[model samples]
Target: MLVVWDSTVNIYSCAVEGQEGLHSPVVCFQVKVTPQQFSAYKTLTCSTTCTLTGNPTYIWYKNGQIVTDNTSPYSVLPNAVDSYSCAVKGQEYLHSPAVCVQGQSCNRVTYTKRRICVLKGSTVDMSCTVGYYSTTSTFWFRSDKSTPEDLTRDPGYTGRVKHTGTYKGPFILRISGLIEEDSAEYRFTFKTYNFEWGHSFPGTTLSVTGLQVKVTPAAEGQKTLTCSTTCTLTDNPTYIWYKNGQNVQDNSSPMYSISSEDADSYYCAVKGHNGLSSPAVYGPKTTVSVSPSGEIVEGSSVTLTCSSDANPPVQSYTWWYKKNGGDYQSMTGPHHVFNQIQSSDSGEYYCEAQNEMGTDWSRTINMDVKYDPKSTSVSVSPSGEIVEGSSVTLTCSSDANPPVDKYTWYKKNGASLTGSEKTYNFTTISSEDRGEYYCGAENKYGHLNSSSVSVDVQYDPKNTSVSVSPSGDIVEGSSVTLTCSSDANPPVDKYTWYFQNKTFQNGFGQMYNISKFKSKDNGHYHCEAWNGRGSMNSTALMISLPGKQTSVMNAAVGIIVVVLVLILCLSGLMWFRKKASKSTSDTRHTADNGQGDSSPVYDNISGMAMNPTAAQTAATDDQDDVHYASVHFSRAKYEEVPLYSNVQLPQPQKQDEDFQYAAVKFNLPSAAPK
Candidate 1:
């Protein structure tokens, strides 16, 4: 009978029932996998060379490791390069020969080692195996940064890193002259036609360290010095020992025996790399000196040199300088030189000499450079618009090695001497203080004079007055020009002409012209001078007409006297005519009353020869009917004397009687009211 079991069992044996001391031999059979060159994700079947006892299970192995336990057929989605095998239950030790999955693309990477450690300054190689369907490119990068960067392009790895091998292959990354900063995880990445390998995969990690010599007590007053490293050196490199700057031993063993009483410095290095040796246990002696042992002057060449006595010689030198108790500034090199030294170059200086073993500092030295005064200048405070009555200050400045000891102030084309100090101040500035000024700066070596600067004092218009052209009298109908004058720092910008209390015209300059001077032009006239500072009105000047205007007034008065006499003569004549008419009316009334007839009577009167008594008698004699006479006068020429009057009588009481008329004459004044 046959029996089957799971593939987990490594060995198998059978015992027959009711058979005493009888057992089947423990057997092992080789498991064979069908389809040796199958594609990825293809199901595979496992069979044994010899038949098993019962229904048996199968165990699958990938890359020499157990993956799963199953019966007969096994299903897997495999990487194109991973190996696979199967085994029967209870016989895991005797499994089928491993077979790799072929064809059928998949993306995968496998590194040769997970972690590596090596000595600094030594070259290292990291390798990885890659699997892909169709690879386009592959590269190696460090995974230490937030983003993976190609090692070949890194500035720190320039000229020290290289990549080798094919796209889908056992790729190699070689780096020479490794440093402590090069310790990081490195990964290999490849790009296929459609996919890229994921960066999440943990890559190989590298740690770089320096070499050290450890001394321990040994037998018989001797000590064993061992060259030590943090990790085992690659390729099992030999060690080299140095004692007091001399090579002592070179061998595979890292241990060296030395006498305990020896007072010598010791160091170590790898056999092939002698330049990258360890630091010596002793310190170096250092000293600093300057060139030109005598007095240093400005613009002279000066240099500071640093010296050290070290086992491996100093690899780097740094010069430090301090001035006026300030912080030290560092400069690199064995010698610090100043091509043209200045007064500012004076300071205390020292140097530090360093090697791989230790560092040494030199004693401080003082440098002093003497020079004359230079860069002399004058500066004014309150830069713009120096107004009158405002305080102002003028400062003198210069650069000197021994410092300026004397300062003298001067004004161009001025007679008075100013103060002998760094600054010249004005308590209350005036227009008289405005002028070009300069200062003299003197030191122990020499003296310098600064360029002149102007102090323009701004003020309101002053001494403002108006002057008329032609000086004395302004004649009527003559052209006249009035000029406004004022004293100002910035000059007058505007001029305004005023007549009496009203502004007549605005002008940009001083002169105001009147084309025709008339009587109306005579008045109190003044002008206003204006500048940026202030405005001022000039004193009023009287503009009077000349003698030609006075004669015109006298002639006007004579014409007025003739007109008044003519008016008086005409008024007297009217009053005499009215009195004559009243006297005639009274006489007529008396005649009519004596007659008692009440009939109208006609009377004729002519020639002023008839006296008033005669005119009354004539009216009484005509008692039958008294009549009043009306007289008519005629006008005469001024040169002639004709004063005549005509009187006509009314119709007589008898209708057929002829009409009667009368003529009258009067005396007239001669030269009618000249």
Candidate 2:
């Protein structure tokens, strides 16, 4: 009977020359008499070939007893060397045996290994070593996570090449077309003829990488393409390209570059004797977003929004501020509010949006704010002098939020006046009302004072009168008094006395005494009373010395009579007397007194007796001594005498009127009439 090997055998099946089945009736070796078949000796190790056919199961036997499943072909148990036998499947078991016998030894030909390669677009013999294989497996992989599975074949390598060899010889895999994804480690597994157990060598990492098949712009058709591999190799790589996952013709080199219509998604694979790496993927999606910078008014609130799109979502938003030459600062929120705006608020602003992919910023913005001035000041019309009962206007204006609403008028006399800064009239003016008045303007905030104005009221004196005591002329030396009184609107502030045009006394009440009255003191006198309005004078009065006026009039009349008598006497004596006497023609006579006492010239004759010559001489003497009292003296009467006689004939000139000449004796004293 044929025996099976243990599970440790790596190469469970192998293609032998003319082998088909193991169950065909055949000879069986004697159990003990076969000399413990020492068919061959070999060593084993992990190899890429062991992975062929998805890690083929193997069985090992020692002295016809089963060994535990351990390594690939057999497990000698460390220093336990022994003869072993392996059983495997074959194509023609009727012509050959399914079992191969060998001995495990410390020094044996088991170290010798084989390589494998799969044809393009076909399942690969993963047991083949990469570099040792003359031809590599074409783009094949076992996708099983724990153990190897069925191999995938690349379509581009189909029908291009084939793999043929013993399971132990170089199991090279081959393909005509090269592709970028065809490069990788390939596994090859096989067994020796004498050593029933199969062994494996480390897998050979294949690098069938080639130049990237790239479709550049037609203008750049002459650009060079590059092909490289991480492993060092003696043979230069050959490149074949596929456009849009299809084979490309007329392109060969380690690097194939073209601007042809089939050059889109062009992929070139390297083919020497190794596998290829995966294609480098490069279709990165890129996008961009645009936004406008926001504008902010100085002293006002503003909002800034930033937007962007990327492969990943944006994480956070941030704002940045930029002045003419200042650094940037991050903002918590897009909106900024300032209770009180200042000049510094004016500048440019920007925002930035960030994500795991990248970051973007918005355009700069500008801000502007408006400003207003304060309230206008107020003033009064007539600033300093507002009269009593007179109206004044106070104007109020301002540059505040709201205009002045209403105005209040205040009187300085501790009284509240009317509303509205102006007044129309005072019913009547009185001195009782006069003081300072100021106005206050009202706004949203409070009150402000208008310029102050003052008022003054004037009046005239009333019920005025003047009195002089004793009801007589005021004498210079005697005591006399004057009093002035009045009832005035503002009160009689002062009393002034006037004598003639001179001012004497001034006060509310005055008593003027004439201590010594002189002639000069004799004149019209008056009193004046004054108030705030004006001063007024009293009716005139006279103050004088007693009896002074009458005495002066009498003395003037007496002097007038004495002047008239002296003028007439001197005229008569000079021219008429002597001439008249000489012209006496007919009547030259002596005259006598009629009465004994005296003689008077009268219309009738009065005679006096005396010696004629003596009398005549005496009369001449008397004329010489006495001055004529009046030119009205009657002509002296003379007696008729001889014309030649020297006679005094002064009377004879009057003889025509009186016709009586009288002579007086020189020695007699003159008599007077009552």
Candidate 3:
């Protein structure tokens, strides 16, 4: 007979009816469920590797407990937590291995570890097993909030968290350089075509902690140092010891013994993870050193490093420097670097190293950076207007590591003026010295030139003169102009004109014009050119009329002479007429006395100078008539002067008496008598 219990199945030999000491062939079977997946109802089936002797009854069990004694196929409601098995009734002692009802296709998750603990600055991996029908996506997330957030997308875990594994499998979440804030519950989630694994399932919780050294008193002036943590570290890792930043020992024990007088700082770390070490515990001793240790020069790379022997090392370093008697300024870093040093960077410098324990200062160091002159310039003394013949000075200034050894002066578009002197002086500055000037400053390293400065000289007008247009022999009734010119530092601003020692009202400009020149316009003319500095007068210019005017005076004198001659001739004529009148009166009286008997007597006094034929005719006509005088004048031609004649006659005789008169004519010779 064969018998089975809830926990075990046994097989035994029975006395057969005809044969004893013989038993049926041993048999083995396996338990299987229909569809091989979880459901509300499942059918349990049993199968054997070898054939049974006859029709065999079936037996079934659930979770190590009998559910039925005989059945064609056992049936039950399946669950994930229960186990089931089946066997033939006669061979019940050889039952099949127990199997969970829910198979590989169940929608569930199981974390490998419920909780994990790790040291700060170390890496940790959380793993889980997943079961699903057909997963589309899977990821690891932190379950600290109601909404699950993927660790890979979290801001605090960027670049430090990652996920590894396939869908519906053992998934892993790896986080490096862990900190205290990384302590949280981490979960795994997956999604199928229609269903998603719920996030309410429990997940693995992580705890991150830091290491510290605990010092304790010991015998014989000795100290015991233990590398301790807030919680027990994972993997039971070995501890390493460091003295003054140097590795000393590594062992499984966390305690280390040392002398109490040891001044060196001590720290510890895990054997495999030396970078994540405990904080050193000691008094801070700070010092600073420069890299590329030599004389620093301009445009060279330099670095200053601050070192300290402090419990936690130097968390911050501050650098302070002073240059050219100025105030001190600060910079922060473990290393203060100058990518390209300058002349102004030459100064006294020091550093301060600080930690949680305390702070310490380094010794002051003078950084005398050698370089060429910089910020070179030329400064002029008496920066006002530079007048000609005035004393002036030009000084060269620069900033250099080594004081400028040589100074040079230069003029634009000219040669160097001075050498090796800081200042250039001019006792008597002239117009020739006015130009653009610059200075060159030099040291042992290099040389540089400053920007140019303009020197302008101011002076009064000079070399003044007046120029005349239409230069020679100015004629009357013609136009003329006088222009004034002068040489001056600044152009002549005002011009004045003078005519015969008097200012011309219309001559207020550089040019004086005479539209219609007359004799009165001829005189001495001058011009005065003026500027802001002073004024100057030009030499007098003589203006005279031409010789055509002298002929007019000669014609006027000739007319006056002709008028005097005419007056003399008229006076002589008047005198002769008076004498003639007196003679005529005497002759008339004597003739009247002698002429008694006027009808019978006749006097033949022919005093008329006439032509012969005219006189004979007059004598025959009137024998008794007496004529005193008669004058005849002819008409003058063109261009000839007319002559006037005056005649006086006696009183008229009786009206009835006959009076005959003869005209007399006198002819003057064309040529004068010798």
Candidate 4:
């Protein structure tokens, strides 16, 4: 605020910011003038303020005399060289500072602003104040204006410019649709009836321009990007920015800090630019990244990408791969893909991005591939025949990337039995546990199984046993076998069979065969297993009885003897009847029917005496063949049973030594001839 006391004209003017709102006054009150510098013969104005409100009416005094205006800016000209002061209408003792204006009388103007910049296609206000005793008309125009045309009514700026302040305005020129052509020093002009004035030397300078961006690298990880214009538009211009064409509303500074992750195109503009942005610019460098990253095993796929910020948009990308101590390989694409990657594909990889504007190379990236375990194997602790009641351990092994996290053990017979540790252990091995065994190794990727290994348990025989078929009361003529067996490792070496007499019955093998069995073969039997360790005998077995009977002979001899005895008894009875008949009747000579020359002898059994030792009937003649004779003897079983002897009487002494004969006949008694 400026105070110009012109004692010559007693005029006051102020060039100050408008105080539209009421201010809270402290202990004291202040007053000022607008357009403090004034030309001579201009209308003099005076104003006053105090520590009071309600739009208080003011009392004006010129050189200690009461002035008559209730409104502010009481216009008055100093008819004489005097001073002016102010006080409240009723409270005149509370006086204000006096302003004594004195200067050369002339039409004059002063711009409120010296220089400014505005955005294109926006509205702007240019203001100034003119102080002249008779300044009835005033206008604004640029410095090169012809005839100093009024900016508000000029033909070239007709629809775009107007006076915001009233017709008597300390001129405020409002212009819309500002353009670069509108940027220049603007002056204010005023006409005071006869004299005209133009003030251009201290006019306000206007500037209009678009935005631009620049990038620079500060440190390894940080980059600095600044947004600027062709020329400075305003004293303090706040900036707005965009990343990948998205507004960054939080950033209000022209410069921004960036890192490797911020690879997108960036642009900025001044505030109130209607979202206009500078041409996009890439920051410090490109960045390279691989997908499916981190400790991947072999046989998996991976993708790599190269990214950067560029002006003309990235046009081409090239991928480079290299192994340890090997040459780099190049492939043209934005991505490098590894499908079913293998160990030979492991290496360092990088990429380059190029455009019509520029080119950049990204930092190297490493891709590791993970896979399931392989080359799996299982091993036993002692590796050979296992002894019973001895400890054994089985270990599983495999190769994997991202090393295997789990191992499972299984014992295999016909089926699988599972356990959770890498090693399976047995405190004491038994015959029941001998079989094929294997293990499975696993990780996040997959699972693999080890090859199976078999175990052979060596043990001494226990609980030896022997068994016999067709055991008891077997039928004859059936074959039988006795088998010997035992529970043992390395098998039983020798099998021996024995009988009840404690003699070795069979020696060749485990079985004793008895084919076409006989009674002598039936007996108690047992077997034994003989080996290097020790020998064990089995429980006894037996074949008890014969099966069936076979043959029959002596009944035929008894039947033949019965028939001969009956014929002899009949002959004796007949002879007896014949003898009796002869005694009772006249002695009829027993005529021999065709008798032979040798007389047949008839024996008389009535006179026969019995000897306990021998009872005999003698044949009187050598031939008794013609006579039927029967001899009956009551015999004691204690005596010699009937003896028949052939006898020749003493007549034959001359022919031969007589064969002795004992044939005696009893003559039959004849009954009456009926």
Candidate 5:
């Protein structure tokens, strides 16, 4: 049995009838296609040999329908494209494999698809041509799909394609509003009118280019940067320009604006590529400074040093000067020297140094020249006045380059010397030490003498007045004082006190004191004092014993005796009465008897007148004129009785109280012979 099947046929079979009654030697046959069926188009045809065997009947099916009267060793219609298969009916063992037909042409030409570049938001035309086509149906395919899918049917490409002339023999395709993803490989198909067709594979590379923005400056101008790229574009490429790592906008072509200060790092970039690499950076600055130059005095020496902290540090220094002398000159070195400096050597001066980077100037120095001297001076201590016997010091001061070597002491009396000891001291000063003194400072240059200092030695008392401590009439051992003072050339040395007529000397009297006063102590006391010059003495004062005041008491007794004699003689009338009474009684009793009684009466009257108011006159008893005479006789007898008794009288008898006194008559004593 034999059978054939092409790729167009999905199934095929054969039927047997009246087989149920058959008894002996009966066989049924069937054929199946392996790997289905295969096909070929155009100049392709089926083979004469079949894959089926055993010489039996065959059947073919098309699209799930049966076909009769199809017989051949292979299949019907050889050299034609078909969808048919074959089956075999046999007595035994019937199965056949399916086969496919491939085609080849004598002259085959591949069609080339056209691609183009366009600006953003523009249409893209894609046209292609193939060498072979007959009644070809043209179609488009996209390369992004696994099985070349139709690109005309994709929504992203809607309204984006316009087939020029109904997709004729050489197809022309256009895509409008083309997106970035639309730019890829596409395959175009042309179907012939009688089922013959041609296909082509085409590819397009998409790129976008931006406007060039060149930031370059003109010659002799600031530095500038630029940005640029290539022409044809499908998807718009993003631009990212950088300046020192910062984003920038560069819209103008061949001219991007920037400032002179913006000369630092610069570059440009595109979205699909790495950062830019065009512009370069610049550095290292320079500046200039202006300064004054020269010295403060004309022609004076001055130095100035200039330096800078620059990239290539300063190398050489130069001095540019307006002569402090009013001229201009140039010189080298940092210092300028002028010998035997003059007044013209004073002015303003400065300096400058130069390097590959820049130059700098220094500050000005003003110098002046003059003269001053150094020497020593002399001075005195206790400056003003000089007194005698008082200590004094004279000092000399001086200043020299190498210092002074010697000090000389000099006297006004032509005495001079050089040594560390410039002073002379006198212990027991005399009038000789009171003179003018001068001093000098001596080195190599001879001597200089200071002014003289004249001293006056004065002599004033040390103890002016001497005193005895116990006050008036001081006794021995009572401690007396002696002080001596004088306004003398020198001072007092010792004190000497004198007692009596002797310079007091003993175990007791040291100066003005004595332990005991003997009889020899009562005399004038004097004190004397002396120094080197002379002596002085105080006035003498006598000293005596404490109780010797008797001469004052004897003068008081003689004044009492002269007062007693004057009181006794004051009573003269008592004496006169006693004398006159005796005379009158003698005459009246005896001698007047022959004469008249007148003589007796006359004597009585005279006695009464003489002793007026006498006691005897009051005692008499008679009141007669003769009674006056008796009073005379009684008074005469009382007066005539002697104060002292011549002879002794007898003792009188006792009487009573009534007895009266009688007048006594007595004889007168005779006168004494002369």
Candidate 6:
């Protein structure tokens, strides 16, 4: 995921110095960048450590190509990822270490210091933030200057390339007994658990240089001095002279002459390198100054000159301008003349004097200037047809000598002052607020008025309602009208009718005419009023169609039939259940009795009974299991009566046991209903 940048204005560009150790101390070229956060943008600056005399020219390059020519502390926007390096124009062979910066994001890498200058034969460590998620192994390698080999295994770096960190980094790569060849673009690489990431960026450049001086005797008991580097540099750069730990006024050539110089330090550097000075040698000091010092006004003419005191007199001088809030501008000459000055030219001014020893700066001086504002105008936002109930704004502007003090607003033709502010705001606009409006601006010198502006306000239809003609249910094929009405400024343009059947009928005007309305059209209806500004919808109006009478009749008949069927079914179910339950219970009751059915069976003789005991109207128990028929003959039909002897069982004792079986008497039930 990419990180969102806040609103800030930051441009990333920088100038670093590189030299062939000519008059300058030989060292690797590198730009060290620092991030500064501002309201506008985020930026990175690249700085370098190089020894040079007078103001040396600087050239900035990106990925080995010249991008800009500027002095040290140049800025580059950290808006994206890019590699950069820099060099002295004349000594193009030496380039500062290149650095690539990636903003805060996945696999984002950044180096604290992009370049380092170390003396030859000294140990040094280079490090950077190698961003990786998982387990990662970091390795160090140089660009084309060296192969992509583990420093521990590469024959050249073996034993000398110290691995100070494991797989995890910000891991440091340490080098021991560094040689001149070690001066190259060093980058760090690493592998994540799932993938490998490598980009050409954020590489450290190392510069190695050794200082040496040649002294020779001159005539008249004087001595001549020359400052040089051990290695032969690319271009033969003029030497920069410095005395007693400060830059000398003379800045040119490696030779310096002294008659009685003692107890002061002296050094030299190549042009473009003012950082690494040769070993300090006992010598005299020099102080540089401008002829006329202190403040000056704009458009004023002034003469500025540079002077210095060294073993050899100052050779030349270069004037430089420093704006109050801007970068330095260089002008070469022994003396600088300003025929005319402007407010933009107001700031500090100084000069650079150079000799064989080194280069130095003079005390700074200051300048100032003045100006004001002139015309006025007004503007409106959203320039078009204005809608009622919407907000609107009018803004006023003016130019002046000193600046504008305040703004006033007014309504044209009305002759009334509206407000006393630069901007006129309307929270909710209405027709009354519309008119020709203008504004006036006043400053220290004078005041001016702006031209008039016009405004229009529009609104929508209001209080819309729907009504049906005849206001009652109409039979099929009858003509019906639905009219939409509302109160609006321009009147309703059209009316749209919607029916309860969920259908929209094509319509226009106020009245919706429905000719030959049928059953399908039987539903509630509503209409909408529309105008140029907006629209409004009305309440529903019900419309009745023919054939609704039969509908009620059919519905009632269906309900009646359904009720009858339900009643009949319920009765049948109850009857079946009751009959089944009674039959089952009767059978079970009879079986539980053990004596079988209790119904009696009687016998009726055509004449009177002959032996009452044998044919007595009685129920008897016997082993034969006999059954008797019911005596149902009418008593009136029988007249004669016979007497019978009492006949008991042959053995009374055995009779008790035989009586256990009971005789079944068949009885006649009552006659059925006719």
**Candidate maximizing TM-score:** 3
TM-scores of the candidates in the order shown: 0.39, 0.23, 0.41, 0.33, 0.20, 0.25
1-674: candidate 4 lDDT, tens digit per residue: 22222211233333232542333222233234334246433244334332245566777665445657666665544443444556555555444544454542323444567676777776788887654444566667776655656776677787998875544456687878877788877877666665555332336677776676776666887767787765666657678878888877545577887774455687887776645567887633568877766666676777777777666467788888897548998999777777877866777888888753346889887655566788888888898768888999888888876677888877775555556777888889887888888888998878999889888877788788887786665766788877888887778878877787375744649787888777777667778787666678887765655442221112334344433443664465446345444442222222223323222222233445323111121222212332333333431112111211222222222222223222344342232111
Off by over 4 Å in 4: 1-287, 292-301, 306-334, 340-365, 372-377, 398-401, 412-419, 440-442, 445-453, 475-478, 489-494, 500-506, 516-524, 530-535, 542-674
Write down the TM-score for model 4: 0.33
**C-alpha RMSD for every candidate:** 32.5, 27.9, 29.7, 27.2, 37.5, 42.5
Candidate 4 overall lDDT versus native:
0.61
Query: What is the per-residue lDDT of model 3 for residues 331-434, given as tens digits with 9 covering 90 to 100?
Result: 99878889998777888999888764456789999888898898999888789988778999999999876889999899999999856799999899987888
Residue 157 C-alpha lDDT in model 4? 83
lDDT of 6 at 536: 82
Worst 10 residues of 6 by lDDT: 1-10
User: What global local distance difference test value does model 2 have?
Assistant: 0.43
- In model 1, which runs have C-alpha deviations exceeding 4 angstroms? 1-282, 293-295, 309-316, 321-334, 343-348, 355-357, 366-368, 471-475, 500-509, 545-674
On residues 1-674, what C-alpha lDDT tens digit does candidate 6 reach at each position? 11111111111222333422222222324566666666333343434343355666777765445777887766766653445666566765455555565533335345545666665556677777644354367677776644477767879887788766664466687887767788776777677676554434436666666555555567876767777555444346567777766777455566877653333566777666555456665422333344346544445665666555544445677878887669989988767767765556767777777654456677776654333334577787768767778898888887553456777888887775667777898889876787788888886546788778776566687888887876766867889888788976456777777777354757666888888888777667777888788888777765666546444466688777756654553443345335434555554455466434332112223222223333322212231232223212211222212222232212213321122211223221223111
lDDT-better candidate, 3 vs 4: 3
Clash counts per candidate, in order, are 15, 79, 2, 50, 53, 57
lDDT of 6 at 502: 53
**Candidate 5: worst-modelled 10 consecutive residues by lDDT:** 623-632
Per-model C-alpha lDDT, please?
A: 0.70, 0.43, 0.71, 0.61, 0.43, 0.58
lDDT per residue as tens, model 5, 106-177:
112233322344443445566654432343455667746677556667777776777653433456667766
Report the Cα lDDT for residue 57, model 3: 79
Q: lDDT tens string, model 2, 619-663?
A: 455544543322344345444333222333332353433444323
Cα misplacement distance, residue 569 of candidate 6 (Å): 74
Q: Candidate 2: misplaced stretches above 4 Å? A: 1-378, 382-392, 396-399, 422-433, 450-497, 500-535, 538-674
Candidate 4 Cα deviation (angstroms), residue 671: 99
